[model samples]
Target: MSKLGENLLKISVILMVLLSLFLSWKIWTKPANHQFQDRTDKVKAVIQKKEMTEVYMPTKLFYHHGSGDHFLYTNKESTMKSLHEKIVSLGFGSSKVLSTAEITNLTTKRDLFNLVYPSPIPISLFINMNNVSATLPHDSKNFLFNWLVMSLDDNKLYFVDYKNKTGIEFDIKGNIASIASILDAESNNYVTAILPTDELNYAGIYYLADSTKLKTYSYIIATQSFTTFSRGFFNQPNDLFSNEGENLSLSNSEGESLTIDSKTGEVNYFGKLKQDHSESINELYYETFQYVEDMGSSLGNLRYFSDTGNEVIYRNYVEGFPVFGDNMKGSMAATVQNKNVFIKANQDTLQIPLPSDDSVTLVPTQEVVDSLINKGVDMSKVSDIQIGYKWQQNKETQQAIDLVPSWYVNYDNMWMTQEKLESILVKGGHS
Candidate 1:
């Protein structure tokens, strides 16, 4: 070959080798967090487009941890109008049985849609008591109400028993907050103590009525603790995210005295309300999930856990699992006086991918019960047993958190964690 041709050939070979090395380096050194970039982008797109995330209401054999055995039944045409009709017909107090075919079709549609669509759909399942599945283990004697409302928002699935004639409601964060509207007039005025619960957290305010005494009650159930406030008063209309998306400001009618960090949605109001409580703690919990005004992020589901004196505590649930934080964290508390509702939430969300269901093996209910009984727990006294995820601080990486599967036993006044519940099964022992 000619010398000029040889030179060109050698240069081309060198360029190809350099390009290949660069590509390899880029692939090998890619950040671990960016692995799910495509999925994250799609989620962002869906949010920006305001796409109606399909909400599935199943009507068939359903088996999950939260709700025992319940299914939604409808004989009307398959349309959104029909769905609304079903909800309205069940208004106040109503009960009726549905046929097997209706349930089968509903169940089929749900399964088929989920299988075809990669994106997740928020689902709420309603189960009637009279027609619960025969194969499912049930405690009819232990039943608290006639209907069960099971809701799935993002990763968390919450189940609560509802009495006949009660309407269902979802908070701003897409959690079941139907019970929040119920007013315990006695507790609202004079509540000194509140125990923890497996449900979402809550908070509110009350007038002690000792020469116009006011108290702000806050509780964090995951850690089983409460925060209180003495007599103090702030001016009316302490607006927080009122005008579309505005940060909260506190003042005594002069000007802005204290401006809360809107991102965290923090508030320190221990005063009386100028207006009535338009929204309960449950409503505030839902609103926080949608927009935090100055806070540039949304939160996961915050389910109602418990309430004490005019206050309620709700916990954050991500990907259908409960998140655990220190006493100062883990849950959101609210204080309501007259109609003024003050919420204290310090939780935030990250757009990270959730661990696959296959990665976490759920502990069976029976096994959990057995473990509790072996641990000397009185089954009769045990209120609720739920399988959920708890966030544990990753000691190896500061500021990083790990979601660990946990068995939470709600007994007496607090939530008990039996980390060793899985160990018994691993050791091949079941009495």
Candidate 2:
């Protein structure tokens, strides 16, 4: 009786263990169902994710000799990307404030390489907005500057505001052998440029010295995800619905709305905002990052174009030139109203580059400015002037666009073409 009972108990125990193992294998092999939004986020993740430095990169790079002449490398895209990685890899040491006089004096004996940002970016903005852990120091913690210049002579880097004439300076960590090799190798494609010292009318803007040829590109464009925007810009995603009108109107019961223009494919979103301080630029920066997870658009090389106190703008760039147009062609904006934030973008973004045989050569910046002044473009209203690729439709196809290089005048921070300004002046109307 004892032997049979013991054997039966052993058999029962083995069966129970086998059953548990079978159940565990089933749990491991069968896929767990995910929620709808979670799956949507996974799809978005495949397309959208960008670093702040990746999006807010410097627009221009200049190699300056000891004699004070500046040169721009024509191999822009590859050169800049490699150089950016190298500089950040070396990181930075302690930085001290350098007055304009100090910078000028220091430049007298140094070979300078400058990386010019489109706008003065603050350190706090990167930290609060994108959680960037850059190698900036405590002394240079919050310096605001648009220019990041490298002094190869002293192995130093200066982050300076050209107009303000003040910036933080930090000594370099290593020798300039790597930087020198790249510059020397790419010297074949270097082009002459007019900096602040060369031309007064450049007005803190850099210009190509002569007429240059640039390729025109065509792109297959698309829009930001409606699902992502609803979750982000609205109070509740489920409660938000749309109306089919002239514009595709999106709204929730919580007084937030976003409208997409059907004809032009422009997007304008409005939402209630709560910030600790009204004048805090950092607050706006954080809000900008929260609503838009990534500044990236498909097939678009977007960078920071400009920012006023109340708004920030980013535009798609090709070979160092910003693309400008109202049909949203790749322009993005974040604006802060009194108690609300307005996020505006084109319903379409550049997706795929198409083949193009088009190219354009425009007159120099000085000649363009002179023509504008002759045409009665009021100088007082013009805050900044720049060359941009005017985004237009291709006559043959609806799938692509023509990017023509043209001079644009920024009227109090608003950009418009020279022809538009001339028309306004002719009509006795303000631009």
Candidate 3:
């Protein structure tokens, strides 16, 4: 009886050990196959989802550079190569300074361009109301030409075509026509031909219409009505007066004086000014924001662009997107010094309405980069690639401006739009 019992117990113990080993092996192998299948399914789903929702708005604003029209890059690599070649052709050999057309191209959306390159002002405004449309390097040989004329009687400005003798009146108020170079204040007659430089600052100039010779004069007047002074020298407003049609001079008995634009009201103060406080760059940035807030203007965030000895530049963001004006100098600007700060903010005048839906599905950043590379963007030459918003006017009106998502590539000392780059790449069969 003892031998039979021992044999049976030994067999049962062996059987139990074998069963446990089998179960362990099965558990490990089964889950491995299942996990692999699960990961593969996820990868496929992501690919399909991206394909389904890839369409985006192509509303980015495009501009022309010198010898180039308000052009879009139809071929990526060639277009970029073209711009790069133009820059290299200048023979500066790595000089960062661009041409007037190139700088105009870079600063066309100065508010956003400052994001790509850097500037001294902290915030820029999207100014479309004052912008006039004309081809770059205004060709004198063109049959049709444009000129700006001021009617003293109505205190109005107009864009006139000499060929057609037609003029579209401007809605500018105030008696500012005298600020132009060619104005007859008594007779209410002033007119000037548009120049390339005028396109930069949108300043006032006067031109006389003489068949034999075209005479021109320029004017800039900056004004200030101060409420706060860093120094305790309280002065009366009587100190300020128009020394000429284009100049408004403000002088204090202390020998300090300021000159301002009579028409645009732009002011530049010279001489010793007192300072109550000196702010760091970050502090100045916050101060600029507070200045905008105090004016009860629209809500927009500031992204620092650049700074110099006297001024700092920042780009304005609304709903977390950058606003683009005609050039990158920005629409909003401030002059902060040791003792006094002067801010000229244009947001109060812009009429940008948010999109019905603020959300957008952007193309993946990597894919965008790949597209750019294919279009001929030398990654080595690109200082940076950034995502921001560029504002575009509809029907040349600021009231119907659209803030669009955009990709900016800073290369060859210029800021170019992704739409221009993509078009070139896609046309090259890279899309």
On TM-score, the leading prediction is: 2
Error of 2 at 293 (Å): 2.5
1-431 per-residue lDDT for model 1 (tens digits): 66677557545544554565466446434443221112332333433311111111221112112232222211111332232223323323222233344322222222111111111111211222122222211222222221223223322112222112222222223222322221111222321211122122111001111121211111211110011111012232222121222543334332313333444424444433433424432333233222222122233344445455666555654433455554324455656655554656543232233222224454445555556666655554444555445655544322234566566655554565655433543576432
In order, candidate lDDTs are 0.33, 0.65, 0.34
Number of residue pairs clashing in candidate 2, backbone atoms closer than 3 angstroms, sequence gap of 3 or more or interchain: 0
lDDT score, candidate 1, position 67: 33
Which lDDT tens digits does candidate 2 get at residues 47-158? Answer: 6655666677776677776454556534375676666667766656666678778866643444677777777888556444444344665565566777778877787877
lDDT of 2 at 39: 38
Lowest summed lDDT over 10 consecutive residues: which window, candidate 1? 223-232
Q: How many clashes in each structure?
A: 35, 0, 36
Candidate 2 regions off by >4 Å?
1-39, 66-68, 73-75, 105-110, 126-142, 196-202, 223-225, 272-281, 294-299, 337-339, 376-383, 426-431
Among residues 3 or more apart in sequence or in different chains, the pairs in candidate 2 whose N, CA or C atoms overlap within 3 Å are none
- Winner on lDDT between 1 and 2 is 2
lDDT of 3 by residue, 1-431 (tens): 36667446544544554465466446323321111111332332333221100111011112222342222111122222232222222211111212334323332221110001122121111111112232222222122212223333334333333223333333444323223311112232212221122331122111111211111111111111222111111222233332333444445555555553434434344433233324342445443433333322222334444444555545554433345544332244556665565544331223223223334445544555567766775555554454555655443222234455666655544455777756654677322
Error of 1 at 256 (Å): 11
Error of 3 at 10 (Å): 92
Candidates, ranked, TM-score: 2, 1, 3
